[model samples]
Target: MILIADSGSSKTDWRGIDKDGNVSQFRGVGFNPYYQTPEEMATELNDEFLLKLKEEVVAIYYYGAGCSTPENKKGVATALGNLFGNAKIKIEHDLLAAARATCGHEEGIACILGTGSNSCDYNGDKITDSRPSPGFILGDEGGGTSIGKKFLQDFIHDEMPAVLKEEAADRFQLTAQVIQDNVYRKPFPGRYMASFCRFITEHTSNPYCYLLYYNAFQDFFKKHVTRYSNYDQKKVSFVGSVAFYNSDILRKAAADMQIHVHLILESPIAGLTLYHKDNL
Candidate 1:
């Protein structure tokens, strides 16, 4: 049996394959060394179904956020090691997962736009170049957090249409105090901000909302995608809810910048499952 995990800042999608090629799926809270301790990760993974399959597990492949550095990767490995004591474990950055899932064995530009964002040039098997994604606070231009941040700013400053502002306030019951507390004092503020994206998506027909998404995606391409040499010659693909859900705006943004989009996926877990199953 083998276990493959695709994790982001908000949740993890786990797929297990048995000897007969049968598959089972499970979900767990997300883990990031930057935010959660090894013990906390273990507790999150202590699900009854996961424990039942532990002894049968021969190997574990974990791709996650904040696993770029060796130290951070090892942190997640340690947590997995404690849980699946006899299983061989491999840990890698989530960008690699996006690359493998989107481009497969083909070279291309792969991007992640979820609660946070990142981009890399994949040379079929490994990442050869990348633009730094300073997370939600400083970057993540095309991600959910960034979009939500823009919406909040417009709403709070009364720059948005009066009707839309009233609707948002009524729908979310948002206030300056509530927004500040969640963004400043809460854990995983990126995820909290991203929660507002649903409202933006719901109101995308509004001109203000439409331009907001377009500008954010345009900024993403300008700042990140265009940084790679020969980027125009390679296929570009995206993986994450932001990319999948807002594909119309994303494609428009790409088109405005003369970029060709190859694919967009809501999550990489499905493609990752196929990749691992074929390799096995």
Candidate 2:
């Protein structure tokens, strides 16, 4: 059996492929080497369904957020190794996952736009270049969290369209204090902020809501994609909820920038499953 995982900031998606080529899936909390220790990850995995298949898992391919640096990569490897003792483990950055999933051995630009955002220049097998991902605070320009943050800012300052503002307040019971508490005083604040995208998505017909996504995606192109060498020439693909749910706006933004979008996936797991299945 082979185990594959694509982990983001919000969740981890698991796919198990058996000798017969049958596939099974499971979901669990997201893991990041930056936030949790190897021991913690091992312990948590033991509680998940993966523990039962540990012995049978001959190879484990884990692509995860926060596994960028060698140290961080080692941390994830250590955690998986402890559980899947008999398996060959390979740990890599989530950017590579997006690349392998979307580009499928073809050279292109890969982007992630979930709770946080990141992008890379991929030459098919490996990432050739990438911009620094400053997480959701200073960066993540076109991600769900960034868009939500902008919406919330406008909401707090009475800058949003009045109808949408009233509906948002009534729907979320949001107060300035409540917003601050979630963003400043809680864990996974970015996830909390990103949740507001649902409301934004529901109101896409409203020009204000549409522009929010449009402008954010525009910012993403200007800040990240435009920096890649000959970016307009490359086929760009996206993996993540923000890109998936807001694809129309994403494409509109891309078209304005003259970028050719190749694919948009809500999660990379499906593409990853196909990529690893060939090797397995």
Candidate 3:
């Protein structure tokens, strides 16, 4: 038995697997080390939930944001180890989760397009190469949160140039307080940004809304993801709700670069759970 977790800044996706296949799923609070201390992260795992598992897991595979540093990974793995007494635990960055889930034993580019966006080149055994993926602030291009931030900025500054603001206000309930709280608070911003993403999905083909994708993806490719241009694998893939649900824009971006894309899986933890079940 194995436990696989793909955690982000906003949510932690959990899966339990046996020799045959995935058997159970449990949802827990988000577990990014940059957002919380080790003790705080450990507290999110409850004893009742631990005891309720159908089987005793032999290993735990945790891939999450902010675990890129060795110290961070050590701290997180130690905390989870204390919680899951008998199971061996392995921790890797969330990009590795996307890499393993998308490319697996093959070679290719793997991307995560959720609240944040990232890309890396994977060559079977490990992540062979990558460029700096600046989160939300300087980068994180082609992500829900990035697009949301742009929408809020433009809408607030009255840059829409027409009556669309009225529809946005009616649909989003985008109050001034909502704006302030989202920016000032710590974790609240991620959720607030996601709401804007929902707004985009609701109006997928709107001409006014279409520019955001071009801006985000173009920067992503030009600044960070261009490393894949020299990669051995011509196929690129994606994993995460944002990319899976809205793949056409990503496909379009790839087409401009002449890259052939193979898959757009909604969730990577599903594949990770199976990978751990077999390899661990």
TM-scores for all candidates: the values are 0.97, 0.94, 0.90
The digit string of per-residue lDDT tens for model 2 on 1-280 reads 9999999877999999999899999999888777789998888787558977987999988999988999999999988888888999988899999998899888999999988899999998889999988888889999988999999999889998999988988999998999999999987788889999999999999999999999999999888899999998999999998899989999999999899999999998998898878876
Number of the top TM-score candidate: 1
Tell me the deviation in Å of residue 113 in model 1: 0.8
Candidate 2: count the clashes.
Answer: 0
Question: Whose TM-score is higher: candidate 2's or candidate 3's?
Answer: 2
Which scores higher on lDDT, 1 or 3?
Answer: 1
Q: Model 1 off-target regions past 4 Å? A: none
Which portions of model 2 miss their true places by more than 4 Å? none
Scored by CA lDDT, what does every candidate get? 0.90, 0.91, 0.76
- Candidate 1 per-residue lDDT over residues 1-280, each given as its tens digit: 9999999988899999988889999988778787788888888889888899989999999999989999888889989988899999999999999999999999999999988889999999899998887788888899988998888877778899999988988888888777888889988888888888888887889988888889989999999899998989989999988888889999999998989999999989999999999988
Per-residue lDDT of model 3, residues 74-187, tens digit only: 879877876787888889899899888878898888888888888888888798777776667766778777888888888888886356678888876876666877787656
Predict model 2's lDDT versus the native. Answer: 0.91
Task: Write down the lDDT that model 3 would get.
Answer: 0.76
